[model samples]
Target chain A: MGAKRIGKQTWKPEHPPVIISAAAVVGPFEGQGPFKDYFDHIYTDIMAGERSFEAAEKEMLLNACFTCLNKANRTPQDMDFFLAGDILNQTISSSFSALELRIPFFGIYGACSTSAEGLALAAMLVDGGFASFVLAGTSSHNASAERQYRYPTEYGFSRKPHVQWTVTGAGAALVARDGEGPRITFLTVGKVQDFGIKDPLNLGAAMAPAAVDTMVRHFADTGNGPEYYDLIVTGDLGKFGHSLAVKMAVSNGGFDLSKNYQDCGLMLYDTRKQDVHAGGSGCAASATVTYGYLYRKLMDGELKRVLLVATGALHSPVTCFQGNNIPGIAHAVSLEMI
Target chain B: MARDPKRKPLTVDQKRYTEMVRDLVPRPPYLRNSLLAFLFGGLVAIIGQFFTDIYRITMNMSVKEAGNPAVATMIFIGALLTGLGVFDKIARYAGAGLVVPVTGFANSVVSSALEFKREGLVFGIGSKMFILAGSVITFGVVTAFFVGLIYALFVF
Candidate 1:
């Protein structure tokens, strides 16, 4: 069997990689969220007994990775590659976890889209026969993200309605050459899109264009309409961005995403009750939802095919403050239960 | 909305998309927010007056002299609430009500101090303590200087 390239950006590998096992570890706040039962482990303390938020993020990622490996009955030495990323500066959470795991690591950075990005790359590696088993993971902490991107956690600054709360959690998945689990069927890499959005607080608006672009491209490449997938989920467009993406998809792409479309941000927390103004946004937003809740759905034969389009705002505080527009990216991975 | 002169001009498609997003995104409830701010701000003022009255009665100080101690007490309470992680939760609902008071200033300073304490005393707590409050202090002093200069020139 030969590997097939579809359309411009989508790829159909000869041998689709199987996600053998996956795990999600969340903080106390996220544990109280709607999808709490799906998560493998929930830390009662946000600090997770770590001295700092950064260390706690790393610990969550490490816990996720180990939980995933333990579920598959695989050890660290069995993994051919460990690809992970985080929203932190230099992706420290992932790199520190890689150091402890002692796996050959590929440190990636896609902001909030990191989980899907890692999954896509890990699938490619397995399909191309470069590796047998790969661990792809990502993590984000609300306090750490707030410290780096916005003001201090305790600051009495009022948030705008569009402002999203960063999720405090980590998610990891084990992709292998052959396994009895969900298979990565199609992958569509996204192009960075900027619509001259400058406000860092309104990341949903900044990121929606890229998500729509990727989804449209995925549909074009696969010749599959929105109805083909039982579920179509975005990474972290929150409420506003998710709506914008739906509108853009219809107006620009000539496709209706009114049905079978949801966002991880909206699924994670009950926005009405939670003080998270818009919704959750971070690397773990899509990650935990897909790996924990959605993965379980697939295993239970609830969903046949699901399209995961993880969106990201590729902007730093320095860049945003420097009067630069925020560019957005999204990667789509079609997962089919096998 | 007036475009920022410093920002690069958007392309036609980009401008159209931006307009679409702006229309689609929900606007903040100004009327409700204003009402909350007004009520909360009045409550804070009432609390300050209570403190001032207590100071006047106990220390035999003039109303003018009691004002400073009352403000200092408010700042102390603000710092305590911030440390307990309660002020931010209130600020979220109170909006400008809590943020436009002396308590907000204390929160700005204390929050930064607590956030950076892990880094150490000099570089973290000391330097970063003014991260948010620095702007307020800077503009406050500058405006005060100009006001003082005008008073000296016109009224003196």
Candidate 2:
């Protein structure tokens, strides 16, 4: 059907939504990363003068949202809607920050995949003639997530090699009805997939199937293979998940991403020196990497097309504690330069 | 080891795949960890007692009351040490010992907050400050309540 809806959940908008401006805010650990130059802001103090980690996360989201708006010389009033989320209990970090922004807010909870999900939704909104401009953002703080998912920092329990460090950063993008920036062309929403994983430590393995499933769906829906995009990036599969996704795609989905594929988790830190175990993860895993580093490359004419697949493990402490399997989801958004 | 009959068994391919992955990964050192834990745990406890002595002698507080300020001081020192990046090194060396005290908790909070500080204050520090420890507090409180219930029912 030429009606924009493709074979499955992929939405190929007649008018692709344009990302006019974007910003990525990272923390000290990320600031020391190889992609340090990609960040817009980095703080030395983890506290950044906030009383608590939750407040710090809220601040990061607000700052990124404002930074994105300011880049376009637009105010909160200029924006039609604010779509944001984080890896926090009830996603209070996003909703509380939304209250301050005063824009028509839509709080999402796709766990760490919130960045891509927000982008996809914002693109659909802009393309569907719903809003002229919208802000899509997501964040994660190391401390906030560690406590919610695992033991308190004080417990000092040794971490497993498979465990990925939660990224402590925020990324925001300003999507416009029409602009002179990279345009969001296609959107692929993921289905929840679970391969019967129980241990929360092996998230990469848990999330790999979801990423592969979404990747397959995106290719099927768009009728385009891996050759279509200049780069294919996953939010935070780390190393193991990235390889597993490739293996799954090649064997089951009949697609190969060997040439142009990267994982934000692996890119965000120096695993050798950083001691991040499997690498970095969380909302910022995709947000900062795509918006700050990759988007910069796109604008600099280093790349033409990019397909960002943000992955999330939909597992809560309650679920894991209750001995339930971890479900995973991934969303993809294709960006093309105008 | 007794196998669970109720649990679904892994397929042959899945079993092989697990073995392949496990083969590549090295086993973690447990002996070294125990030694460090013993040493570091004792050292940290000694430091806590020192602070307790200071609070008791200088602040003129009783032994029971001195612990509050001592624990608070230890937390502050732990956070400070973590901020300077000293705690991490100690943690790496001391292993489990570094993880058992108020200082370890401080390190967790400080390190987690610091990890994302650049993301901004509200979310980076405020939000992540408790990620590692929030569960501990919640569970600790919950367990205490249940234990208190038992005590009230039987003893108190």
Candidate 3:
């Protein structure tokens, strides 16, 4: 199902104009290991050198925002808010970032789905007659995330291919409401789901069901079928999880997602670049796909209606020890030109 | 004047073009649109309920399955907000809307780090890598510890 935006040129709804001005990626999985060598290269090659993962992440996001605004010919002063987040405590990444922009800030936490959730909130604010000119974003890092979630690198824990590759990078996009840009007409809120899977190591399996659940809900709520949108994209659910999600959706939801399905993690690294057997995290997945694929498609008029689903593995190490598989969840949003 | 080979190639034309383009494009009035995006985003969620129903009735999926679609929808809406350029707008209007929920924080981190990548790897990629995820990781760890602590304190 694909949506074709009608009357896009002159149709500016009460909603503000929203468009992604620019995007960027920074990471270190370029040449780190044999199994996941190339993933580190993105960091080595794209970013240049290494630093504290947290520091690097902060720099990456700050740079992305600056570049995005620069591309749009706007400045931080032009923005009403400085929105940011990360998979960290106290949202240090975003908090620190706020210090840089010195603009009013909002910090959020949605696991990997942070990017999507941020966008949804911002759009709702626009639709509700609230303030405008907001900036929303999300990010992650391999070292920091791994150390926090599991054992530090010194522990030398072996990672399973089924496990998702934690993307040590950040991505950003500038959104504006309703004039001379893509207009977001709708968004579907996600319902949290725990499929009783508790393995933190294998996130795809944990998150697949959640992705299916949210997608099913979105379609049901909209009264739209798979035929309604052109593409259905999921956040970090990589190869295994992506496959599992499709199967679950068809078997459980009675809808086949094979025709129009993609995962951000799957897209982030060329399997050749990184040994990421599955998918990447939220920001890398969101940023790359949004800027790499979706943005281009929007520009080309190749797609009219798109159902983008970002999935997250909401699991804690404590839960894992408690004999829990990763808890998975997903959220949906609709993007239309009209 | 002799140009130093070590000075690196500088493109004045690209800089000039970027400036020209910036001045040429008109920025939107974000105050109004972000609110609309929010409304539209909410409406999308409301509409998603119908999709949830379909999953339940037609497909015999569980409430969880029915609701999964909306998760993706929500994230897409977030991206759309960023695209509309109103995400920044509303972030200014309502702080809670962006921070309290899981989504808003995600965007803040991802968007901020992306901006820093241009400075190059040492300064760009490596430096700005985990800005957003740091929180989730911390929360995951601390929450796990507390959750574990509680289990140990009570169940164990």
Best-matching candidate per TM-score: 1
lDDT of 1 at A161: 88
Is candidate 2 or 3 superior in lDDT? 2
DockQ, Cα level, model 1: 0.57
Instruction: Supply the global lDDT for candidate 2.
Output: 0.85
Model 3 TM-score (2 dp): 0.61
Ranking by DockQ: 1, 2, 3
Predicted candidate 1 versus true structure: per-residue lDDT over A1-338, tens digit per residue: 23478898999978889999999999998888999899999999999999999999999999999999999999999999999999999999999999999999999999999988999999999998899999999999999999999999998766678999899999999999998888999999999999988889999999999999999999999999999999999999999998898899998889999989999988999887888888999999999999999999998999989999999999998888768899999999999986
Docking category of candidate 2: incorrect
Give the per-residue lDDT digits (tens) of candidate 1, residues B1-156: 343577668999799988988898778888888998999889999999999999999999999999999999999999999999999989888889998999999999999999999999999999999998998899999999999999999998
lDDT of 1 at B49: 99
State which candidate has the highest lDDT. Answer: 1
Query: How well does each candidate superpose onto the true structure, as a TM-score?
Result: 0.97, 0.78, 0.61
Write candidate 2's Cα lDDT for A212-262 as tens digits.
889899999899899999999998988778888888789768898899988
lDDT of 3 by residue, A1-338 (tens): 22321221111235644765645555645223222321212455432343555676777677667766776788888787766778776678778877998777888777887777777766765666564577776777776676567633322112345666777666566667545555666576676766544447666666677787777777666567777888878888877777777767886679888898888777666776656655576555665466445765776788877777777777766666555445566767677766
lDDT for position A290 in model 2 = 89
